[model samples]
Target chain A: MTRFANPKKFYNLSQKLIPILGITTLLFFAIGLYFALFHSPADYQQGESVRMMYIHVPAAWFSTLIFVFMATMSGVAFVWRHPLADLLAQEAALIGAIYTSIALITGSLWGKLAWGAYWVWDARLTSVLILLFLYIAYLALKQSMQDKPIASKMLRLLALIGLLNIPIIKGSVQWWTTLHQPPSIIRSLGISIHMSMLIPLLLMAAAFGLFFLTILLMRTQTRLLNIKTIALLKKQDQLDDPSLAA
Target chain B: MHIFSALLKHEFLLLTRNKEIFFTLLLFFGLSLFLFPFALSSDATLLKSFGPGLLWVITIFTILSSVESFYKKDNDNSLLSFYYIQKTPFILVFFTKIIAHFCLMISILMIILPLFGLFFGLELKSIVILSASLLLGTPPLITLIHFAIALTLSTQKTGMLVLVIVLPFIIPILIFGVGTVTFYETGQTLKQPFMFMAAIFLFVFAFVPWIAAYALKESARQ
Candidate 1:
């Protein structure tokens, strides 16, 4: 694992793994969509629109998962002074925010169908909006700094502070009366599990997780290349004038 | 301790020297409170109901304008370097500055609350409860504003940047704060909102200072 911390090793590994992640992502989504949209029975109450759950729930789950990943990468950047970790965190935050946005929009669409209003100032909704703001602020602050190291540390500090909101967001539903639809997917085992619906949802979730890793490694590889390019350029300039090269 | 007090003194002196800004913010607070009657429905009932929130919003902004003095005063002095060498506990600096802010906010509130009461036709009894809530609430106000200000200390426009950053975190405080005065005015018992604000105050007091202290330490190293 430590050896893979080398950008060269990571880059080589990513090159090998992308085709696998790519093919599997395509296969999983295609199969999942087929099973989800066609094979699964419509909800007795929600009718056809309940099909939105397969996408909405997994995306929401992925959004939270991505934030945790971003936070962990932020922690790594702070503790070990890892330059790559900093970049990984920045990218993940943007991606996580996009995921969250999709979740909220889709949730709203579903809410309009289910609740008769497009928006409600509920505990769950307010907390998600707050989470989105935290992501935007983190990204904005990170970009605003001109000093790389200072930006890294400042953003990491911001991320850590912002993390306090995450648990609040997660628990908001439990703590407050809200208009949001409660957990639809994570039911207990004895509750007549439908293997048909469950398999596709789980597959989609796994696919998105692998998809995140694939893109993260690809971005990391590009960043490593950019660093190498700058280093090469500097060395070339030195070679052009040996007297000052030392 | 000496360095922090010195920094605190420097911050206060800087704030005092810019009496125009200090006065402008205070005036903004005053005028903003005046808008309460006009902005809300002119029905005395509706106006009375929402009056406390406008006053609290004004108070928060007045505090925000002054809190930036902590970062801005470092412009000529390089006090962060001075404190770095002095090895001051960052939280001590944080608390001292927040204390100064609380003093300013409270002074502004003291001067204005009665004015808000008289002009807006506020119920006197509820005003008293509202004042009690403000007294309990303002420590956390200073504390969180300092935390937010420190975190965004390096933003190009620190004032607006922090306003954007902290709005969500401040909402819970706003809910309890405004709820206290509004509920009290509605002839209901004010116990719950008061307790809620107190709890929020304690939470921010304990949490925000530590975050601010850490951010200040990080900013100093730069």
Candidate 2:
């Protein structure tokens, strides 16, 4: 865990990883999209519209999945004051919010086609909506505080708390009667989803994960440069101040 | 008589003087609800079922929108330099400001809930229940908001950010706020959410002001 404590070491590691992650994401999504759109059979129930599930389900999974990951990263930043952790967490938030926005939009579109209703206040939908709000709140807290240290500490506490909604979203179907279905392949009994469908779903999920990694590394590099720039400006201000010499 | 009137006068002036702030607060309440029609589908049955929760969420946010306004005023232009020298007990000043904000929030909700009901075609009984339900639910929420506002006082421009951070802490109040109206509308007898909210209200009112008072003093020192 502390191996990432050094920013230089972390940056060097990320520098090596960026290319590999970018290519893997590219390869996985290319094959996954092919199988998802053409090869997979329709759900015996929902028919052709079931195709949207491939995109919608994975999109939903990554959104909540990445958010919880970002919250954990926020904790690392706040607890250790690891500069790399701070950069990575900030990067994760921006990417995670985008994931949530996409999931909501896609989920709504999928609902429109499949359910005859555009939106439902079912526990599942409401819980996911709350998840989106949680992301917005995290960004807001980050913007409000000027001191980065204090902001990190504050944002971490909030992220950890907001994250409780994740379980509610995942379990809402079982806990309450909701329009959304409970997890099928990931839960209970043996693997029910056909390999043709399951393979691409898992592949897309992996691609999205790598995509997040690639973007987060790029963001951290930029943030590191910004911090160094600020430090340079502070040193310049001290050097230029003549009155303080006395 | 002199000291009491002077403090009351100060608070009254603070509450009444900010026309822009007042307008902004009202606009926030109105506009937050206004977004629903555009974002949500224009279906009546859906709105009927979802309306209470949506409106409650909006009111919670509108009150949150203004939590920083008073703190911003007290922290004017580095003039906080003089706050320490002033004779009024800072705690009293803090409580007075919080009361002023709460009054504004309650008044806004009173006027807006009915308007919301009319716009969304909710029944009169639902509106009445909503009004009472919101009143019961809001105090603890506002109390929690004020506590967080005071703690983050030293860090200016924390408004939206502060709301997010404090949001989870106030979940019970929100859940109960939703539950209160749901319980009333359903005519169910579980009756626990409202009582739970009242207990939380008492807890917040008892502890929050003291915490805010301590934070206010520390901030003024800074």
Candidate 3:
């Protein structure tokens, strides 16, 4: 892990890994979509709209997963003062925010079909909505500050603080008796969902997870390249004006 | 221990000397409350139903508005770093600040409650419940506001940005704060919501001072 903390090393590692991740993500999406749309039986209750769950659940999972990931990276940065960890956390936030919105929109669409309302103030829905807002807040904090070191420290703290919301989002259904369904995939009484549907759901979740990793690596690479380019430009400017450099 | 007391007293004195904060916030809370009756019809049932939530929301606005005043003077004058350089125990300074601000907010809430109750036609019992919830809930809310202010202390144009960052975290407090009274009006027990508010208060009071002190340190560092 420390080895990858060096930007040059991480950049090289990601360059080799991106193609493999990209291929796997595409393959999983294809297989997942085929199984989800063609093989898995529609819910007796939800009918065709139940299919939306394949995409929705995975996106929702990744949304929360990415936040926890960002928070962990932020914690690493906070404790170790690792600049790379903060950069990874910052990059992860953009993807997390995108995934959160996707979850909300898809969840809203599914709610409209399944529950007869485009929106509800139910516990699960409301908590996830708050999750979206938290992501936006993180991104906004990252952008608002002008000083990099100060902003990085502050954003890491904010990320850690915002982590209080994750458990609430997870337990909203159970804690409040929300309109949203309780856990189905990992229950005490074995898997509640059918295996046919489960396979596709897992596949889609893998695809989404890999998709996040791929994008995170790409964004981190771009940011590092941007930093290097700026440094080189500064060095060139100094070379052009020796007196100013002195 | 003596230093802590002295610091606490000093914070209270500073707050009292800047008496305008209390009045401005009280007036702001009053004016915000005044707008609601006009905006939503004067129907007693509607006001009665909306009163708890409205008061909590307005209180949030007041808290957000007062956040700058709470830290701006010290931050602008570099008092925090001075305290840090003097080895004054940064956490103690922050904790006392939170305590003093909490006391000030409670006093403001106390004065406003009767009028808010009368304006919204709340029963005496409901007023008591609202007070209870506010007492238990406001510590976490205020600490959060201060924490948000500390985080953004070095940023430019932070008024709205602080709100954007903090409001998302305020949802649970709002839910349980309003829940305490609203649930009672509907013939439910207040114990559950009050318990949750207490839990939040305890959790926030324990951790926020440390993190907020760290934030202040970081801001002062640059």
Candidate number with greatest TM-score: 3
Q: Which candidate is the best by lDDT?
A: 3
Which whole-number lDDT from 0 to 100 does residue B192 have in model 2? 65
C-alpha DockQ for predicted model 3:
0.59
Best by DockQ: 3
State which candidate, 1 or 3, has the greater lDDT: 3
RMSD of each candidate? 3.9, 7.0, 3.2
Per-residue lDDT, model 3, residue A131, is 88
Q: What is candidate 2's lDDT per residue for A97-178, written digit by digit as tens?
A: 8887777787777677766667765555666677777777777666666555555555555565456545533443233332
Instruction: Give per-residue CA lDDT, model 2, range B1-222, as digits (tens).
Output: 565556567766877887677777788888878788778866887777778889888877877877777778667764344666664466676666766777888877777877898777788987877777777777767766776676566675666556765764566566666766666666766356557667667766766666556556656666
lDDT of 3: 0.84
Winner by DockQ between candidate 3 and candidate 2: 3
Per-prediction TM-score of chain B? 0.89, 0.88, 0.95
lDDT comparison, 2 vs 3, better candidate: 3
- DockQ by candidate, in order: 0.41, 0.19, 0.59
Q: Write the per-residue lDDT of candidate 3 for residues B1-222, one digit (tens) a residue.
A: 987998998888889898888888888988989999999999999999999999999889988888787677787788877787877877787788888888988999999999998889999999999998998888889888889988998886789889999977787788788878877888877788778778778877777779988898777766
Worst 10 residues of 3 chain B by lDDT: B81-90
True contacts kept of 2: 0.24
